[model samples]
Target chain A: MADFLSAYSIQNWLESCPQGYLEDTSYGHAVGEGEPGLLMDNEVLRNDAIRTTVQLVLGERCALAASSGLINAAPDEASKRFLATQTLDEARHVEVFTQRLYDLGVAKDDLESVLSTHANPHLVAFADVLLEKVDKKDFVAGVVGQNIVLEGMAFSVFEMMHAVNSEMNPKFCHVLSGTIADERRHVGFGENRIGSLIKEYPERKAEVEQMQKEMSYHMLATFAAAFQDVEAINELEKIGEERSHAKFQGADLGVMDPDEMEHLLADTVLGEFKTRLGRIGLEYQTPVAP
Target chain B: MIDDVHELRTDEFLAEVHSFEFWFQSIEGYLSDSTWGHDADAEEEAIDDEDRDRLISVLCNYCVGEAAALEAASGMIQIAPDRHSQIFLATQVADEGRHLEVFLHRLAELGVTDADAEIAKRASPSLLVFKDRLLELVSGKDWESALFAQNVVLESLEFVVFRRHAAEADTITSQVLEGVIKDERRHMGFGENELGRRLSRSPKLQQRLRDFRPELDALVLATLKETAHHLELDAEEERVLGKGYLESVERLGLLG
Candidate 1:
């Protein structure tokens, strides 16, 4: 009987955490006058924001669906309880992001079209692989892939976004702050469960390490594909410049470069993923360059 | 206001509020013949062949029902929209899992080693149809419809059946049924709370629920007839069971 973590403790933690609910008018201040990026003049910035929100909405929905499978495959009472709470968190993420997209002027049908057509294939494939692990009842693999890798990346990205855009997009920043706290707690569960598995069966360490390598390769592919979209990259670069200017007066917005911003995102996500793996007593094996 | 018809009379339930450990310990005690009056010497003389067979059949049906409830509860935890509901359903997954184990253990005491195979072999056509409909409801897109079928219909009927059987059975079996009935009542409470909240927000949904009642009642009746046949109930007994089920449904007032 695993007594290290109890379901009652998780229930208490969940109850104490802030519920993240965004109102319909929460984003009005970000898009209206006096905001740094007005829609009329910042079409590139506005389109990029909408596109990112749409992608997040789709990704969170995929996560929500996968949590269902994980709950079914959970090996014990504690894991089931933890995964159940995760399902709620993932569903809320989907709901909030969907509403955010709608607030950005995307209709429900248009949002669905974008999810089906414009979602990055590599990201979709990543979700599919994690879900497949859950279907196969490889509970450890599912936790490592979905919670440690995917959610670890989300935590890092959301933290960085919230820091940079707190003033420009207060509503989005507030939402990310709450979500980041939830993701941190989720990753803690993965670390605890994976650590226990390794201690019980030393041979399973090799299998988990191999799975992590495969996930890292997919993560790199997702990032590489994102960088290939010149328009989105250019818009990100402009937003980065604005953020830099806002932080320090007399900073030249012209000096902002897209490749630098891309490298920053990739490095932060990968670095955090490796750090998380180290905490669980697993070494991060570098994937072969593709 | 939501009517009292949707309320669960938790106070009337037999089992005290206990932790999962306590619940499992009680079940273990039952298996070991240390509790519920299953003395080693009396066990051999307590039941005749005919009575043993009837008990085994009833236990098999209970096992099948608990297995179905376990699956539905697992699925519900994933799709529940709010944290409180998800937490409740998660505990239910544990509760149903424990109940299934209890039934399997009780069957083992009767020299039935292969409980799953026995359940499959004894499952009637109507039971199979009910299982299929249950699977569809639990996996459907509308959460309220799932709640209506599982919590309001199947569980409601099971609660009444357990209550009736507990009243008539020996000390041991009655004790087990009492604990199970308590769990069933809590599960039904969750469904009522969720379904009531959803219906109150949308009058259209209330009408859809009203339209859904007959289909659910038909499924319940079909399962009841099959159960009566398995237990070899005469016309009066079948009529009594059917009437009890309908009265329970009327008390729920799900159609209105």
Candidate 2:
């Protein structure tokens, strides 16, 4: 009898869970179209959330790409076990963010549309990349294509958001903090995997470098535009303007001019590579913007 | 521990990147010695500080990759029970370990202390999948069929990626790839040649090829599509790469 009750609990709770309400706020849970139940109602984080979600979705994308690259190479059982774990980690990430939104109140209807939105063109391309139809049939090469280029940039943006949230935004701090930890862990997997992949395929080294350089241009520009959003900017200032909202706005929450943001993003990535190179006294001249 | 990675994350991820820089340079130093026309030995020898240790650390990471690869290949040997198949698989494992040696030498020459954690963290899941696929192939009752499928379908696709990276890699960044590519090229040739030879001896291999076509095509399509989209290189680049690579494979009579 107790086991039966426990088994039925999850379904019962889910059925009764009020579908629409934003963190118990009257903000309509989401000002979204059609259904209002989707929890990632916040414009910025929804976009961020979806982008992060795409990274997980794209993990299998790497598996497909990796198979293409393994043509001549063979891996053993222990390595296979590692792959299995990696697959699980990626799948876990996708679910975590999806549930995070659903838990907060995201509607299933909004989720689909949001995924298809202009905010996520890269994700679609990633799907195409993993399917190997766009241009390259090589999946290992595609791992960096989706993982490094698309998700890598998204990770950087998330890293920035993590910094801002940690330094400010006390209300959402706990959840955001946990998310940040996960994102950082995901990033570790990414950076190490990508660096090693490129190392394994040196001849295509030029190709990987070229792709990264191009993606850098697109990624930085996207963030600059996002930061310059008029409505978000107004909201940001409002936080600083009102005492109650002041906690969400602070030293880390200050405005960054587009030019400065662009330069800063590039500088940060370059600095990272520079430091990696510096350990062994090797240096690289990063591709400069025209 | 990812403590190092975590610490690096705090300064707005600059620290994490700086850590990346350390590894990148070590890889450079490791590979640079092989292509050396001029000796920087005197300068390097004079540096008794952390720099020496840095070199060793990079090489150890290389060793981790080798150990992991061998472990994976050993899994393949276990699955591939036939004497002939086992010999081939064993050689591949030996090749992987030798490839690992290059980096190991680079590390000992440098002064790396602890690369186990970092290297373990870095090894891609994609690499490990090979072992799983190998085990499944070998464990199946059809030993020759498994070998043929692995060689023709799997190794051929991997060659496409390895060849592309080797051709396009920039100097310093290409170090690790340079060492691995040579071994991969030979491995690919063996797979292709062996698969073809096995087929000539047995028309029984026909059923497997026909059955594999759709699956391989799907894999190829998914692999190509995702790579192009992810890399942001566009369809044109993918086609060019495909055509260029196919020509070479055709020349080798592997694709015909």
Candidate 2: TM-score, chain B only:
0.53
The sequence of per-residue lDDT tens digits that candidate 1 reaches over residues B1-256 is 1134225354312112212222223333333332222343434337778877887887787776776676677676555774345545545665566566556667777788677688777655555666667767766646777777777777877887778677866666766687778778877766776677677788887788789888777877777776776566777877788787776556545545
Worst 10 residues of 1 chain A by lDDT: A19-28
Q: What is the per-candidate TM-score for chain B? A: 0.78, 0.53
Model 2 chain B: which ten-residue window has the lowest total lDDT? B15-24
Write model 2 residue lDDT over B52-120, tens digit each, in one string.
443343334335445545444434443454323443454455446445544543443444434455446
Give per-residue CA lDDT, model 2, range A244-284, as digits (tens).
22112122334555455555655665565445333322333
Over 4 Å off, model 1? A1-3, A7-10, A18-41, A228-241, A244-256, B1-152, B155-256
User: With candidate 1 superimposed using the best TM-score fit, by how many Å does residue B109's alpha carbon deviate from the native?
Assistant: 28
The CAPRI classification for model 1 reads as: incorrect
lDDT of 1 at B152: 71
Per-prediction interface RMSD in Å: 12.1, 20.3
Candidate 1 global TM-score: 0.58
